[model samples]
Target: MSRVLAFPAGRRAKWLVLVAWLIILGAAAPFAGKLFGAVENDRLGYLPKSAESTAVLEQQEAFPQGRVNPAIIVYQRDGGLTAADRARAADDQRWMAGKYMPKTPPPPPTVSKDGKALIYQIALVAPPDKQEGNYVLDAVDAMRKHIGDPGGGLEVKVSGPAGRDSDQFLIFRDMQYQLVLIPVIVVAILLLVIYRSAVLFLVPLFTVAVANQLGSAFVYGLIKNTDLVINSMSTGVLSILIYGAGTDYALLLISRYREELARHEDRHEAMAEALRRSSGAVLASGGTVALGLLCLFAADLNATRALAPIGVLAVGSAMLAMLTLLPALLVVFGRWLFWPRAPHVGDSKRAHGFWTRMGETVQARPRRVWALTSLGLAVGVLGLLAFNVPQQTQFTTTPDSERGQTLISAHFPAGNGNPATIVANAAQADQVKTAATGSGVVGAVAEVGRAAGKVQYAATLNAEPVTAAERSAVHRLREDVHAVNGAEAKVGGPAAIQLDQRDTNVRDSWITIPLVLVVIFIVLLLLLRAVTLSVLLIATVALSFGAALGVSTLVFEYGFGWSGQDSQLPQLAFVFLVALGVDYNIFLMSRVREESRRHGTREGVIKGLVTTGGVITSAGVVLAATFAVLVALPVVSFAEQGFVIGLGVLIDTFIVRSLLVPALVHDIGDRVWWPSGLARGTRQRAERGRELAPDKSR
Candidate 1:
């Protein structure tokens, strides 16, 4: 038997053996002590202390016990609240208090000016931390039920942290419809287009289903040992990986198999050769992407860090499925995968003249094209400095847009949408009290504590009006609190944490931005075998990144009024910019080098562009569209992420790789690869091949 079917010996065949071992090991993993130990660990809810701990203290001191839960009541009255409406709202509040809350009157209920909106500032009998069995959900549900149907012009509804959180959960549940539907619909369409055979389509998707199961099982096991918060976005991201990477790998394998069939070879030889030709590219591409995701480990935030292993594992599972399950299925199905299309062996030659003509035109005048592309990119990049990152926390939204948003907007100061508490360990009680009364403070409350021979004051701040200015207040509060006589104080709150996040982000960007660039540069140099070419590629990618950020800044800051500096924005941008941008560069430059080696610098540049342009452009379109789907999400942060990354991919394809780099290669001539001995050797070898080939054949 040939090595391909042998399941060892051959590098690609060995993949089958290796993956089989992994599957067996993973299957047996549930019995292992490590897996059980991870599950048994109990450190789940411990979020890392934000670097902005001191700042949070200041904000907390200004707020009412750092608790700002406002219950909203919506009712319409003909003129004033009918005796009926007031009675109904009051009865509903009473019923909620009896059922979930303690039977106590809360702070006076504040009604809206238009007589449509009313807010009741209710206090929980148990502190928020001690609420039982999702008390918030229980209370809200109880409130909704008691609101009594409106007879004429009266209706009542409830909202607050507890209320909104419950609402968020409900929205997430409803989103399950889309989550399930979109992937199924998209995969079905793509599969139909790619395979035209239903059985072939089903095979890859079935493999993905298995990969997803194994991926989730492994992830659940990993999280047992780590303190991680899996956000709602995780499911979407995992789905993308399973569907995207799985289909991409299948395409590669199937395409090669079909090519092998043209030679009329037996299935075994065809499968082995298919694996031999395509596996390197598949592994290279997958490895690069996995490497990019793993870079998230460098982030300090738990959310980003948590994503690191999940992303790595998800892609790794797909890779395993591709290598093992996919190959075995192909062996089982053989030539039938093509069905009506039938497997046909033929040289996979790209049409020559298309890229050659484009290369020739670009080479003819590199300066005009370069200049135009640079100007367009510069204009986009200018939007970066003007952008503002909002601290707004209205991250989730419902399908009923106008109503839910209007109710939320009417009831709370935008900053009150998400308020975090701060506790400062004070050395002296009096000093802590005095500091809590600072001018920026709207209100204050405290819990006295004695631990380690020092008093700890859990000071609460009325952070209702959180703003960029409020963050400064938080900073000033920290300074004032720390300056208290004869006391050491430490601060913590959401706003304070946000401020700390800003500072940490600034520092991390300075460190990681260069590091990312270096990694990308090294990859480019290794791949292209040219220092000048690599440097230019990096420069182009940086420009594309700047442009992408600029576009994101305008959309987020000016268009949508969202905070531009999302917790994950900078790092996510860094990863996408370097990874996706370099992908474009690689696609272009690989063809560029091959064409140049065969055709000389001028003809090669043209040929490379003409040949690779369509493929890279298509790939960019697919990748960009994939990310663009995030805009449909209600969260501003997600919209910004999708738009920015999508724009980056588009810009990298059209402006950087398609236009600017080609011109530069044309303009630079031999110096593009100067200092690279291998490029020179490759060019010489190409010349010898030309000389040796018969004139008629050439």
Candidate 2:
């Protein structure tokens, strides 16, 4: 296993491995550039075919209007609108009608009861060849430009589905560059600081960059050719995962390589030994994360399910590069890459450091150390009481669409712009409409279109879109419409979509969370070859996850003043924190197990802590910082994800892995590795006892 792991760094194979990676990168570059183009951001792309909303969307394409994207223009004034303000709005509507809807004039503007605001609805017809999201974005941009700067304190802004989509598109477009550039900068700076070598940081950075390119190309192929669902959010996460996890793997291997370099004369031999020592932990870490992400395949939401393939590919690319390309590159560069602090054969190992002092402190009162850390983490769990699902306008800066919606809500019905859509059999259309209206949740029901034996109706809700009240109303609306016999009725539109998204996310959390835990536990068992140790590590990581989430909840609600979180945030956060949190433990414990064979479990724990503390902490900080880049995004969901995950990583790194795990193991003694020979006081114990005996000279 060790020889195979080290094969890429072999004397002859190093150059060959480099050549192979270059060839693959060249082939992948073209496809990588096209990944963003293949992303599916339309509502249909995120909804499964089984969803009633999806059914409505599919049926809508058969109508004459054919899945039109509505852009609502809100014209408002604080004072009651004058005749000239009304005339300007009318002229703008006429201009929009002549330009986009030449044959079908839009309905006349509806005036507010206060006479302070009017809303004009225009349905932008989607072309057969163009993507729905892109088409809406283009049309909305043109419309916004045409209605630029309505004067006299009369505000004009586009809202509804089209306007919101346009704003989201702008954020996603910026995300492509921001996610890549910012993380790369963060990782590069951290690597330089950690290594303190001018040349050493570039090898891992270059390797991970190549891995990212390769991962993107593969993802593009899946999205372009297969039924895989890829979105802007998933792609953004993919970039972060590649850089963060890939760099982590690089750090572990490089640290081990430096140690080997101090012991062996040949760089190739040193690298081979490093791979032999560290590759198992690296493989286990990567496998745990990949399988944890794979658990998302059980998720009902298309967006969540899409993360399964994206995460697997991202981790795979990173692991492959770190295990193969990075090792090969390091061997080729030789010890010179370390520059001023280069390690040489026969150099004394610097095992005692600040971490050794920490271990000694824990050694004095292990129980007290673990107890205090555990209590602090448990306290943070209380913050879960504040968690709630945020509103649809989860953006850092208020977009034009949100401002327009606010105006519309203040004047007209809250759901006037975005209504719940119902599709039913043409024969029972009237019955379905009557049932929906009588359901007591709908404010108004209007026939939208009829085609292919089906009729569609847009039912305006009494509550605001995407709110709990709106979700409840959609449910009642569905129950009423379904009661109409043989109508085959389904309630849909934006509000229903949100309701389904929330329910699916709930279902997904139940399924994926357990699956991730079970999968990780199994990996830990195999990696550690000790059931007791595996269970303990899993428990510690879970505790870390809860504490991080609890603290994040408080910060989100109180510090950021965010109304709530995204429905998918909890599941995503749990899977990532648990999977990645265990990684630092894997690095530390794997070394502990190795040291235990010679020094016994008690001393081995201390040695492992002192040896691995710096690299693991550095790796954790790198991972956390990379995820922190998501906070730079204007979208609240991304920012929340970034902040929570980043904080969780720091908690796991500084407290859980650094102090708690080591202290608990110290207090537990050899029993922590129960059933292992070291725990049984075998022949190795006699040698360990002799080594640890007090030195009379000292």
Candidate 1 minimal-lDDT segment of 10 residues: 36-45
For residues 70-150, could you state the per-residue lDDT of candidate 1 as single tens digits? 344445454667666777767766665565445444444557566655555443323445422234445556666666456
lDDT of 2 by residue, 1-698 (tens): 77789898799999999899999999999999998887888888898767888888888889888776678899999989999999989999999888778878578899999999999888887777887777887888898899899787989999987788788887888678888989999999999999999999999999999999999999999898888778898999999999999999999999999988888899998899889888988888888899999999999888889899999999999999999999999998888899989999889886667898988888788899999999999999878877786455467888998899889999999988788888899999889989999999999999988999999898889998656788888999999999999999998888888788777787789999999999999998777777788889999999998889889988878887777788888899999999899878988998888777666777888888988999999999999999999898888888989999999999999999999999998898878877666677623765866688752210
Error of 1 at 46 (Å): 8.0
Which has the greatest lDDT? Answer: 2
Each model's lDDT comes to 0.61, 0.88
Model 2 TM-score on a 0 to 1 scale:
0.95
TM-score of each: 0.78, 0.95
Worst 10 residues of 2 by lDDT: 689-698
RMSD in order of candidates: 6.0, 2.9
